[model samples]
Target: NSSVSCHIVQVFSNSDEALINKKLPKELLLRIFSFLDVVTLCRCAQVSKAWNVLALDGSNWQKIDLFNFQTDIEGRVVENISKRCGGFLRQLSLRGCLSVADASMKTFAQNCRNIEHLNLNGCTKITDSTCISLSKFCSKLRQLDLTSCVSITNHALKALSEGCRMLENLNLSWCDQITSDGIEALSRGCTSLRALFLRGCTQLDDAALKHLQKHCPELMTINMQSCTMLYPSCSKSQMTALWFVCLAAATSQITHTHTESFIHIACVFLRILEAARCSHVTDAGFTVLARNCHDLEKMDLEECILVTDNTLVQLSIHCPRLQALSLSHCELITDDGIRHLSSSVCGQERLQVVELDNCPLITDITLEHLKSCQHLERIELYDCQQVTRAGIKRIRGLIFNFIGCCVILGVNCVLFC
Candidate 1:
């Protein structure tokens, strides 16, 4: 309340204008203005030229968070702030700033050379020109989010890789224009890169994976959801069925051909892999993944209908540290597949979260198989019609609340306790 009163007096000085101005030093006034939000600071700037200068000081604009004012942030507003911030800005988040265009981004890139974190998520108007400017100026950038920036192509990625080698985390999800070439260039240049989100990038194939395997040794997380072209075949169901049929005869041959080269390179640090809806990834592809990515802790294979018990068995045998696994909508998986997973060393000792949502074929027997999994915490069986309340009740450490035949289990049950 006292702070609000002081701010009011600082702005609306009446007969005591001279007294208030003489009493508070400029340094003290600037410090007080620093505590105010951007909107409040803008209001203070309207009071007087002295207050305007202090409110719009470079120190006050070091980290401009426009997320709260997403609807209000326009190209002119960002451009004006960039002009004022000069070189002092370190973090700028314009997430969902629909009106932000390439010109504003260009101005920000030119002025804020020291910016380390920039979030331009859903900024549809931005093009490759912004990326070109950023690559030329923002060399210290560590985290960049260009999610849903559809116009961004390989040219922008090439520029970024050549310039911002310090980039650690990048989210390129929904950037459909990107391909293996740009990803390869990035991996080759940004050796320190750790987490990459390529979800919905349909153009990326095994070639991109090979590039990451060869270059990014420190890479830990990769999300390739909806990348249907990663495999050689177009029809995921037929290709997977063929792979499963030939699995016995071709396991050694496929492993020798595909995994021998980069198996060691990938097995070291790769931890999390989410390839949901990538239908082309069959047992052969998953075999290479399971064999190489031994340190994989979390994996999501949602809607990957081709994956059979063989892949789960391989994951169980190879990835002893495996903890979280999601096989949602994978119609091919049966109790036999889950039994293999539960019997595995990792499943018995370390597996914690398991999501089998929409897996229609899974019965109560599947839950019975999981009794030996002492470390098991949470199991999601949403829409699994075959699993009855009595079957779910048999599992120890999982207590269900039966409310009119609807079995609801607390998410916190045994998992956190």
Candidate 2:
């Protein structure tokens, strides 16, 4: 039926119902058009009068990701799209589209009431007004990404909480203006929330974590990277010191925390947790996390310097579904920690990625212990000065991928191709 459009111009006018129905009917053709990207769809719209009508169908614009047009997308274009697609638009991503502001989003929200997944990350010009509009209109909204939307504050969270009750996943990463009050409001209202990303939201302390844990019990995934105020286990003095040091360095990497529903490892609930660079986080914090989040499949504890081998023991014993772990820069972690992880149930069947980069305490013996992790695919040991070629060669078979890792041994450096 690929050639059914050969008589494209005359097909629409064909009086024979059977002849037209047997050929590429409008519904099936639109279904085929649904797969095309914006550029190709536009080209198809220019093919002929028949194709133009078929191609411009709003049903085919239900899910649109304009992330590629970050620099080129204009507010006029966005407004035009809102009118053209109207209620047919369900999911749209204007991620990094700085040109489109509150005006365009207001129009969009009014037109696309059924919008479920909206990514406004990097739309810095937008403020609480946009959220109010979305709250007033888009009740069906599910996942909302406001990453790097600096103008967003507690007021925005308040609006979203009041309106978008169905919201399940939200990314407020790098929104420094939000506080525990906002989080509490969001947690209380969005009780069905599962994944929340708050990396670099330094104002959020342990109080915010408590709010999420108490209200959002269904929460399976969270990113608290660079959220130094999270660890309540640290003493006042330690917390103050960590607050100063971590915040000073938080802007170093220009990190972007994605709240995109954490890796869906388990069909039941994708339990992924990331607390990387939470320098003040002690073993007590991780112990609580491991106990409560037993289904945790992926965890990033990189630079959580206060964590010791006890943290590993807790994870190994409780979190049997752990598949990926990053212990980079956790100097307290020794070979024993790796052994504890490698001997666990996760190591036997689920463990896949182990990043131990910059852990000076670990020697070549850590590699030997990792051999027990049958499913281990990548082991990061890039800067363990004590590790020799002999030790890496011993466990090289277990770690099959060397794409992002290399080791320095003596005068020679081993690079994986």
Indicate which candidate wins on lDDT. 2
Kindly list the per-residue Cα lDDT of model 2 for residues 1-417, writing each as its tens digit: 557666664555543443444687888878899999888999978766667877888988888889987899998888989998999998999999998899888999999999999999999998999999999999999999999999999999999999999999899999998999999999998988877888789888757756765677666556666665544322111111011011222322322221111111112233555556656557775676566567778877788787799989998998899999888889999999888988999877788888887889989898778667776666677688778777676556556543343443323554442
Using all chains and alpha carbons, the TM-scores for the candidates as numbered come to 0.74, 0.76
Show where candidate 2 strays beyond 4 Å.
Answer: 1-24, 231-271, 279-296, 310-319, 394-417
Per-model CA lDDT versus the true structure: 0.74, 0.75
Per-residue error at 83 for model 1, in Å?
1.9
Q: CA shift at 70, candidate 1, in angstroms?
A: 2.7
- How well is each residue in 255-285 modelled by candidate 1, as lDDT tens digits? 3233333343344445665556555457777
